[model samples]
Target: MKTIASTNSSAFGEPGIFRGQARFGSPMLSDYVWPLLEIRGQRPGPRLCVSAGVHVNEVSSIEAAIRLQKLFDPKAISGSVSIIPLVNQPALYKYSEYICPIDGKNINFTFPGSKGGTFSEVLCDAIMNEWCAGSDCYVDLHGGDLRENVSKFSIYQRTDDAGLEAMGRRMAMCFDAEIVVGLPKDHMQRPGRPPTGFARHGRLALMSEAGANGLLDESSISFHVEGVLNIARALGILDTPMSAFRNARVACNDYLWVETPVDGEFHAEIEPGMRVTKGQRLGAMRNLFGEEIAEITAPETGLVLWRMTHPSLPKGSSVLAVAVEETQVGQA
Candidate 1:
């Protein structure tokens, strides 16, 4: 078992960066080594964990994380921050599909995993046990995958612990995303949820989304960087004041997912962040002969959270997700 050295030093009180590898699977099929970045701050405070690339196709999140690691100066901060910019190394290296090619599992859905399970599960176990076991706050950055087009949003899980739930909400708000989603506690308790993997263990956690089509954009990268800085300020890691925003943010408590009824080529008429009334036409699907196979419509008056960008979709695949607008007039 390879070990990472501690970064604490009392002489000049400067931040230390430690880069190391964590073992993942057996040597028979193939061994995997995951990279870890440990950044220790000058003064003592809470430990903030930021991770990206849980889904390898989310290029913007990975780019943002890399930029964040370079931009942060431990001399100006109070606590330690650990970043794992590329969690799914195999997927990133191979440019694999949405799931880990080795295990054919989505790492995001298999968190707090078993040590003796599949490759993805073992990696998840290592991250939970070694990296996030005692974290004070956790932020998982994500973007639209290679085949998705999504609007900017942040999500926090609803938990029984009021304080943890509140902290998660505050972090999501500090992100200043166009939309803030509060996932229901019941849904979080269901099997294979990512944020719940940390929240259920008493860690305050949330996720942010931006970018799409497996591409990197400057705007998306900047949005994620600013969000992390805001989170640092909100968590007291950074002494700087919180930044202000011009537009009022919207809060979403529920969302509807539209799935493909048949295998075909999809053509979307609406884009992310567009508001549509119930029954409005959103998209359509066509077969090779150009015959329309399906017509997707809005289930309710709400905001389009995400849409499928890849034209070819299998039956039952999700075409888009809509966040239902709340009737109340305050932030959730």
Candidate 2:
């Protein structure tokens, strides 16, 4: 891997693999450049980019990106795949969670950021304007932070373009995840959640999640790695016969969270991907004396997507979250 300096156009100009470091937009961090891996297949086709670590604490997704950077060969079927293993470089090194340490902003929400903006914004601007350019399809990898107990899932930010939305849904279901969902950008609007600005990029983008609590579990890592490969196969980015589509994928437009009204030690009786009916006791909030202070019940019948794995619960903490507002797209 030579320290080659190449633009995105030339990076994908010809059929080959290029690996190097690209400069970070932050002048304060003048000494650091983010790692970039570009692989252009032998045949001309779509350009797919896989990014991770916007929330630097998602260790498994980051590890999977690192593995994917080297997994592809130049002789693969068609198109190119760009791997950005680490996006929030400052937060990653400083051990920050969801937000960037330098700018105190969650890089997740700041899309198509500005050059004159904060550290997080500048980095985000590069991702949306530069890295995401010429990408036919984009996949952003993320997962639970240090305090979250998230199960695997994928969501494509719904767009007005019907074709793009359909492709995004296909991309979401092509992976190995517990479920998949499609919701408008206005549904949970925080700028844009899928790395690139959907309106600006005008391309297919989806977010996939696995792993949790900053743990580098191999199973989670494999989930992400296989997910990307499966997508590449389904999208014809790799040299495979392409039989990796997960035919059964559930969709939920909104989530119903089971929260505690008071601070107490929490006990969760359900895990992610389990089915629960309304009024079912999902967990309990107990006092220091081991008294059941409150019973956490499901407000709706749905699938459990995520739960609070930690026993310590603060006031208004969500013990378990169920995927409500569901639409059965296919059979499992």
Candidate 3:
């Protein structure tokens, strides 16, 4: 491979680091670039790629990626680590919009994208094809957006590849979040496949979520930073032992999405990570005159994975996401 910033191919075989930008095409006014950080260890091992800011509003993940870039030292690792701290610079620069303003599409839904497609698609294409083509592992960091309040959790795909699935599970466990979700083969396939679409193309991939509501809480940021370091230790990239969290990891095989029954101002009575029983009241919707328009109830007993942070709710808008715990099928 060719060299870009400071480090060269020789550094890939020895301890060194490189910092540069992966340039894509230009917009009307300025050039498009994704900041890239590459760290090569003294000993050769797996190539672990970490990225965040796919959803620009997920600021905690972005900050975690930034902190992780400075924490890793090439002399202390056994493999290479590549980090893209902020993936959607345009969206991020545009006040943390959920979708790219240029194309009005969620970049996370566009994977293995087309070079000739819209702005988001072209950006995804460059990242997947040029930056993350071959890798032993991949972690897409995310958190709740400006209008999302969510608990910390990690998700991994339950794939046909046993080895890849196992690796993904281990990485998820290493994150040690409050919950570990196993997405089925067909999870989130509509609109477009998630970034985990890389798994179908033969890469061990996982995603971590923390922080929410466009706030940068230090606790949330620390959780993500520690999760990445824990995964590194699990992968043997770092010699440090795994650190345990307070809660035992809970596993979920599916999620239930609750949508608003009427358009009104929403007031959530429950928070993420809270447990709810079937038929329990989760929140309520009120009309403009402050009259109760509808009551939001839990569909089943489960943990609240995420809740809508926005005060106003439109009819049919998703307000809460509950992760249903159940039996584990197939081989781990």
Candidate 4:
């Protein structure tokens, strides 16, 4: 249930920020506009490329990207900031879930995009070549989609490049979330699997996720805004005080998704971020007649990070996720 929301069709048409569209050579996308905002600072420094709405119903990230346009002054900023508020414009237009509606492709899996590919591939290719080309910091903002709920966290990768890995960790910690999740770079670089948010850029790439259930929650939006600002300040893009990554209380080695094995209505007893012991009953699945069909329990003793918000669950759907195998990262 979202209390606040943008009353318009697209946030791009909002008054505060409007840079011309970044044209991709896609005839299928000729009818729509791909929103791009560039803010060049008076001073020279590192460039930052931030993208949101890779999953269209992740409204909080999209809203944060839109707000970032007017949050900083061009004169105070160093170098520039490139923001793509809504990457899946068609999906956003139709309120589609994770995949792009036009091509039914997950933008996350397509990186170094192919020019001669489908609409989704072409659009992502443009972004990869245009914004993620150089030594710039790339951030892919994401969160729970229309039916999912997520807590605040940041993700970095364990890439082969130590320098890039260190920078990614620092960037992930800048989000000031209690948890920082790490993924194997080999997994991201390996083909045939979901690439996990274009992290294979082989640079300072990370992800910030907050807000959930397709809501425009102010706190979640601010979480993203402040996190990006922290990174910008740390990278000298802004004049604000630089706050390096220091708030991570736990750094997990992996994040696990819990899939429902049966089709039923879900009843979750625990909210995200709750700490539960192994085998704790997190929830239960019931048929339409209210007969319990399955029991949902914590697979491990760790923090529950996210879950599906909608009650209806189909077998094999990712209904919950947990942060497991963690180590104490920072001071409490």
Candidate 5:
């Protein structure tokens, strides 16, 4: 890792800024610290902020951030690169929860939060005021929550706004994830949206899923590391080739959710990156007595993008897949 001074302030503190957990006091656990590496290049460029561990258990992104920080030399970079690997350190450490242990709030959903709120919300506000709201671009790193493993992919919001789309697409190309999922809608309108979640508006942000939940998978880790490098190069921060870009960019607008018919022991017959047809049986559910409870099928022809790894589920638990069709409403 690149050795730099670790100071205890966000700005006006030091150049090699490593702000330790500043006290937000009791009502909010200020334990979740923000680590930023401000490498001012010889020439100025766009500010890129990469955040990981917002969900805690999705450890790949955190590892990727560490690896990138070490290998990332600001002298070689064109602009600033800020990284907050453990955004939800409370959850990652104490409770070992996917969401924040203090309040069970998802850090991702609690963005642009209030100053005097709960731990997660306050941290969210701090992050917004300290990191995200100021940056030119933000990359929210995530792995599939708990049971779900994800294909190497990034998400971009698809809207009529072309500028946002362009930025997202460029980052997607640099990251070169297996597929690029488009999230057109914001988190608020989302049926089962988490209270503290990502903003689904006109923001220049991208979500990258590296591997499964819980542990660090090497393959996914390597991909994430390389993905960051690729983005750096593509954004003109590093001198390199963009040929590392791999996988097709699948839009989120062209995808659909695969839900379970009834609550039971869910199983998946297909993996995240598999291609399937409309009538294909993606998976099934069974009861405690080994009796088949419900059969899950694809609604349309497309590729299986994500599925639930947690089998013991409740009613309406999203079981298997989001498919991106070859041709959809708008593909040009």
Candidate 6:
């Protein structure tokens, strides 16, 4: 357990207090918003905003945000840092499945959202209009889906945006995550669809993936917390030193997607975070008849970060996993 400083507290309703709100408008309904603002040091620094619990089952992020909030005092930090511990309040109520019942939408996909629409849509619109209006950068935290087994990693948009990429690299370094994914092949595969990405206004964002949803993993929670702290250090919000991996940075073009070739029971031999070699058997697909019909192999050498959890798989369903590849941090 690393220690971080918590400086003076701000008077409620004062100029620089980090405040939380519930109703941005009609459609957007979050049970509560936990907003904390930290101002430290002297010179102006970048404003970094972090959000968690976009998906209710992915509760590790929420824990991470809470831990981070306790570590530092807003009035003592160098720059502005806003922490939103739980983004999907409705879904988080009882560790429910994805999407809020109020409007039933995934907040991540509805970015720069609608003014008058579903609850999630309204929440996105208000967040974008208010807290995220002029953010320097943002971080969207997450974990594996409820029905999947995934490891710790960080996802960022693929591009040659030098400044953004550099910042992303530093943030990833702090996490010391197993894999750092840089592209979205699925989004690219679809002709007109812009990639599965994130941002508040125009800042480059980092989407962190940790353990499987619906289960609490302490290791995952610690990893997420440390990662957020590193980001705070990078942005100069906190006067703490960098984490262990302040030098090593990994770059991956994209993660590999493994799909069910045939309908059968998915007997995955490799769990999340296992390193795999190219041409290796990732897992075997067997039908209810107990007959092994398909052998899933790695398309390229990489780490297995995410895998389907269900025993049965439908033909053509994705049973994908991610791997980190070797690459230099060239000028983007």
**Which of candidates 3 and 6 reaches a greater TM-score?**
3
- The residue pairs in collision within model 6 are 27-119, 38-74, 39-74, 39-77, 40-76, 40-77, 40-78, 258-320
Prediction 4 global C-alpha lDDT: 0.74
lDDT of each: 0.77, 0.75, 0.78, 0.74, 0.66, 0.66
Q: Which of candidates 1 and 6 reaches a greater TM-score?
A: 1
* Candidates arranged by lDDT, highest first: 3, 1, 2, 4, 6, 5
Can you write out model 5's per-residue Cα lDDT over 94-133, one digit (the tens) per residue? Answer: 6354677778776666655667777777776656555555
**Best candidate, lDDT-wise?**
3
Q: What lDDT would candidate 1 get against the real structure?
A: 0.77
Deviation from native of the Cα of residue 194 in model 1, angstroms? 2.9
TM-score of each: 0.89, 0.85, 0.90, 0.85, 0.83, 0.79
Tens digit of per-residue lDDT, candidate 4, span 170-228: 77778967678777655665431222334555556678889888889998898899899
Q: What is residue 293's positional error in candidate 4, in angstroms?
A: 1.4
- With a 3 Å backbone cut-off (N, CA, C), the pairs that clash in candidate 5 are 108-197, 109-196, 109-197, 110-196, 110-197, 182-252
Writing each residue's lDDT as its tens digit, candidate 6 over 1-332 gives: 01122345543323354443324434234344434444333446667777787777777777777777667665577666667777777776666566766677667776656676777766766655665556666777788667887777887665445566666666666676877776643443221101233322335567787877567788778878888778888777777887676323356766767888898888888887777877799889997789999998887777786888886889998886756575422322
Q: Is candidate 2 or candidate 6 better by TM-score?
A: 2
Write model 2 residue lDDT over 165-231, tens digit each, in one string.
Answer: 7777777777677767676446434555652365446667778888778899887787788878878
TM-score of 5: 0.83
1 or 4: which has the higher TM-score? Answer: 1
Better structure of 1 and 2 per TM-score:
1
lDDT of 1 at 192: 48
What TM-score should be assigned to candidate 2? Answer: 0.85
